[model samples]
Every structure is written in structure tokens, then in C-alpha cells.
Target: MTNNLLNENYWTTRYLNKSTAWDTGEVTFPIKQYLDQLDNKEINILIPGAGNGYEVIYAFEKGFKIIHILDISFLPLKQFEEACPDFPKAQIHHQNFFEHIGQYDLILEQTFFCSLPPILRSDYVKKMIELLKPNGKLVGVLFGIDFQKEGPPFGGQMKEYRKLFSKEFEIVKLEPCINSIPPRMGTELFFSLRKIQ
Candidate 1:
């Protein structure tokens, strides 16, 4: 059932048809700012469901080497490789995030969570926990508001997120995104959660 929503063919078709409205064409300001403040350039990082991956490019430009870019579809990964020809080829994984394996010091979430169907939220959280090293952090933004329309960019709120992630992560910061882009302002939550042992 869930596979039907996130089926490889479905997302691949979306990219092929240019139906991904979630492709911002640029990294969101909140995520860029979050990366700007992180000084550790060598930490192992994973960006799952990384479509277009503007943020990953931004991080790489700033000297992060151990970054893994994972996505379910091959289209975006190919595009990413074209854009960053020198990016480590081995780190670009064309696979399902749930099936992929790795321990990372950080995982960056941009619009990935909202892209999944609502039913997979719990599983998403569990997979995130399993991928992080002890005390590893997950940082990024989430939609603070919901879209009434059916979505590849689904919507969620703090209450549901807290309940879903609290079992394996400490919600260090879950609050309104004061610096969200004008279109996303007031509708976004910037969060930084640390994995719990």
C-alpha cells in the first residue's frame, strides 16, 4: 500500500514529467543557515530522499566530505552527479532509504519527510534512528502547517512529529521557522533532534 505511493516508478515518472513542485531549484534559507553554522566538515552525513539536492551541493562547497546523497529515484541522482561531477560517486546511492544502511553523525532533512505518505511517518522515524550513530543529530525543517490538497508534499504538525520521533530522538529544537522563505514563512518548523542511545 505504502509502496504504491512511493513506488520507484511513480517518483521516477514524476521527475520525468517535471511534476516535482517540491524541487525548489535552490536550497531553502533555513537549511542553508543551519549548515553555515556547523563547523565540523568531516562528519558523516546522509541526505535521504535528496531530490535535486541543492543543499547537498551547498554543504559540499563548504568542505563537507563524508556526505551521502540517497534517493529512491535515479533521475535526481543523475542530475546531481551532472551538477557536481567531482562529488564521490560511491556516495550517490540510488536506493530506498528504508533499505539503505549506514551510520551517520548527521542526517539532513529538507522536504523529504513531507514527501512520504502520512502512513509511513512512524517507519520514517524508525529508519532515521537506525541510521544515526549514538547521539547523532537530525536537523532540518518541517511544514508547520498542512496543505489541504492531496500531496507528494504531504503536510504535518509538531504534535504528530514529537510523538513519532520522541521514542528514539531528543527533540532539541522544534519551533516556528522565523527565517523561512516568504512563501514558506509561518508554515515551517526548524528542528534539530539528537538521537538517543
Candidate 2:
């Protein structure tokens, strides 16, 4: 499918039809552990394409007050608002990630990357670099294997990922995730990339 087909309407329809199999219902293990290890709750954080805002809620409840969640679609953001009314409404952004502005101390990647068309991978990296502060981090899991079928849950291998990201960021950690949830156990790589100065 074309990039245009994967726009707001595509995603919003998926949410409306309850076709979001990617919604894990709650924060996943890898992300939960990464957030758990953070000693500084005040660091500015962003979760782009944060459908349902699961991690957003989790981080807020844990005292990370400066966190932000962005999504192109409004339905899930609306749902998230109802679910976490205590969360500051201004911090919830209903905008396209590529058009988003602001620098973050850290950006959490969940299923967002793979959800985009492969053609946008480089643009995704560029936007990430643009959005991060100097020496800031982009950390999360990525699929470590390829899928046989076409995907919004598209997959990729480690070497290709390394080549794509290493040009602009320091690959702090890019290896098999030992803490992935059961179904994703051996298929994901837990990565931490620091924006190159």
C-alpha cells in the first residue's frame, strides 16, 4: 500500500473497527522494564504514534509529568483522554509525527516504526533526529525478523537497521530482547540509540 493510504483515515478506521491487533491492552514488558529503570522522572519524554496511550498513562502514573503522546488519529487520543482525565490535556498532541515540533530528552518507540511504510523509514530517522535534544536517546524494541506477508506490523533484520540508524546515532544497544512478552520473545531487539552530537 502507498504512504497516502496509511494516513489518518486508515488508522482511524482501524481503531473504529477494532482492528488494532497491535494494541497490547496494556504496557508491554520491554517498555515497562525500561521505564522502571529510569531514575529521572523529570526528563522530557515523547511517545509518537502512541495508540491508546498505554505507556503514556503508565509513565504519568509513575510521576513522569513532562511526558507527551502524539498520534495522527483522534479516536484513540480521545479514548486515552477519557481513561486518564487527570493527565494534562495540552500534553496530548493530535498531530502527524512528521509535522510535530519540539525536542525531547527521550523518545519511546513501540509499534510506531513498523506501522509506517518502509519507504518512510529514512524520513522517520530524520524526524527522530530532528525531535531529539543533543545526546538525547531513542529507545525501544524493533522487529528482529522478517515477515512473510505484507505488514503494518512490517518486519526487518538487524543488519539493515544498524546501517540505517548508525549514520546519525550511536547504537548503544541493539540486540535480542531478553525481556519481551511471551509471543514476541525471540523476535524483537531491545535498542537504545543516542543522537550523535
Candidate 3:
């Protein structure tokens, strides 16, 4: 990870100090719309880099119990546990996303990708493919504009993201996010990519 780009301690400290500006504090619109259309409740789902875990709570409340939440820092996981006490303790994971071992039918990407070094992006694509079951989908939002500053919320353009993710994932959906929150309205892209067979 880049020295300036927030890694485990950087992110953990953000949570510890309640300085997580990236945190939406609740499920955002694009993901919420995606979840609303889901007809199956039995598919195994995973959300890595799951800080605050509002989406996990959203899914759990809507009958999606076969969900796993992972984070590199335990701080946010602890907060999530308190926020949703009924969620299974076993489902909360504190570990690196690349090191996590599990086959998931669906993996939701929130703010995780941008938090790492830009050089790790390709590896992120490959690892997402590895963690998924055949035909499993990696669905969520990505920043669509490059930030001028060094970042944990590092951003990139659509063409770059499309090229990076194409090698391992079939580009099923990668477009400007129409339903993002006000602050993120024009800067986010909602994507859904399936592991290539």
C-alpha cells in the first residue's frame, strides 16, 4: 500500500476517531436498489472491507442471513456487532480481503478498492474472481473521477476501471451511477461483473 494511501492502521484509526467521511452511515441508493430486486434469499454473500457495515445490516434485515462481513481492522467490525447484535458472530471477519478464504455467490464492493494502492487494482480484480463461486457477481459502486489528493478514497476514471477489471471479470454492468447519494451523485459508477468462466 502507498504510504499516504490508508492501509489497516490508517483506516482503523479513521474509525477509531470517528473521522470516516467516506462512511455513508446507511445503505446507499445504488446498492439498495440492487438488493431490492434480488429474489433469492439463500445465496451466500460476502462484503469485504465492510466498514460500518450498514449494507450488511440492510441485507440482514431483509432476510439475507447467509452474509459474511470482513474488514482488515477490527474496530468497525466491533461497531457493526454492536449495531446489529443479531447478526451471527461467526460471519464477522477481521482480515485482509486478499487473504480471506471463502466462495461466495455474490460479493459486494463498497469503498474497498479505492482504499488500497492503485498498483494493487489488478490484483484486486484477480482476487475477486478467485473468491467467487462460478458465475458469482461482484457488484457495487466505484469512484468515477480522479482525486487531486493522495487518498484512501483514491478515485479513477471509467475507462481505466473498465480496462483493469476486464481481464478477470465479464463486464456485465459498468456505468455512471444514477442513484448515488447527493455528494457522490456524479462521481460514482455502479458496476456488476461476473467471474469469467
Candidate 4:
């Protein structure tokens, strides 16, 4: 799809039509394991393009008080609010990710990057640099293989990902994921990159 077509209206329409095949209905295993190991619950965390916000909810329930969720479409944010009523309403952001401003100690990525048009990949790297605190981390999974169809769920290989992110961030870990859900088993890469000072 064209960049213009991937706006709030398009995503909102997807939610309205219940067309979200990407919604796994729960936190995926790789991310869940990563969150489970985080020692600091007090760190500032952001989950942008957080559809239905399963990870946000999981973090909050685990005692992470300063977590935030952002989505371009208000529909998923509304659903997130309904699902997580006690999450601070002020922390729920309804805006474009590129327009968002905040410094996070940790930013959780799930399907957000692939959903963007490939043309925005550089912008995404720049924005991650802008959004992170010095030495901050960006962690989560990305598709490690190409798909046969056109995509809102676009895919890429580790070499391209490393090339794209390594200039501004230290590639702490970027490897084929061993813990993906069955359907995504051989297709995902779990990554952890730290912002360079």
C-alpha cells in the first residue's frame, strides 16, 4: 500500500472490519520472555503503534508504572483503555509516531516497524534515536524473511536491519528468534539495540 493509504483511517477501518490478522490476541512469546527478565520496573517505557496493547497491559500488570502506549488510530487506544482501565489515561497517546515526543529508557517494538512503508525505515531509525534517552534500548521482534504478498506486515532480513540500525544504535543482539509462536516460528528475529551516545 502507498504511504498515504497507511494512515489512521486505514488502520481504523481494519479494526472496524475485524481484519487484523496480526493481532495475536496476547503478548507474543519472545517479547513476553524479554519483559519477564527486565530487572527495572521503574524505567520509562514506550510502545508505539501498540495495537490492542497486549504488551503494555502485561508490563503494567507486572508493576511497571511509567509505561506508555501510542497508536495512530484511536480505535485500538479506546479498546486498550477498555481492556486496561487503570492505565493512566494521560499516558495513552493518540497521535502519529513520528510526531510523538518523549524520551524513553526502553521502547518495545512488536509489529510497528514492518507496518510502516519501507520508505520510512530511515525515518523510523531517526525517530528511535530522537525518542530514546542516552544509552536507551529498543527491543522486540521483526520479520526475518520476505513475504509472498504485498504487506502492511512487510518483512526484511537481518543484514538489512543491521545496516539500517547500526549507525545510530549499538546492535546488542539481532538474531533469529527461538521463541516465536508456531505460525511465525522460522520467520522472526528478536533484536535488542542500544542507542549510541
Query: Which lDDT tens digits does candidate 1 get at residues 1-197?
Result: 46765678888898999998778898889989988999999999999999878989999999999999999999999999999999999989999888999999999998889888888888988899889999999999898778888876788888988888788889999988999888787899999999988
| Tens digits of lDDT, candidate 3, 61-160 | 9999899999988898988999999999989998888888999999998888878878888878888888999999999999999998877688999999
Segments in model 4 whose C-alpha atoms lie over 4 Å from true places: none
After superposing candidate 2, which stretches have Cα over 4 Å from the reference? Answer: none
Clashes of each: 0, 0, 0, 0
What is candidate 4's lDDT per residue for 64-113, written digit by digit as tens? 99999999999999999999999998899999999999999999999999
* Weakest 10 consecutive residues of candidate 4 by summed lDDT: 1-10
- lDDT-best of 3 and 4: 4
Per-prediction TM-score: 0.96, 0.98, 0.96, 0.98
- Give per-model CA RMSD: 1.1, 0.9, 1.4, 0.9
The ten-residue window of minimal lDDT in model 1 covers: 1-10
- Sequence-dependent TM-score of model 3: 0.96
Candidate 2 overall Cα lDDT vs. reference? 0.94
Q: List the candidate numbers ranked by lDDT, top first.
A: 2, 4, 3, 1
Report the lDDT tens digits of candidate 2 across residue range 29-107.
Answer: 9999999999999999999999899999999999999999999999999999999999998899999999999999999
Which pairs in model 1 have colliding backbones? none
Q: Native-vs-model 1 lDDT?
A: 0.89
lDDT for residue 68 in candidate 1, whole number 0-100 = 91
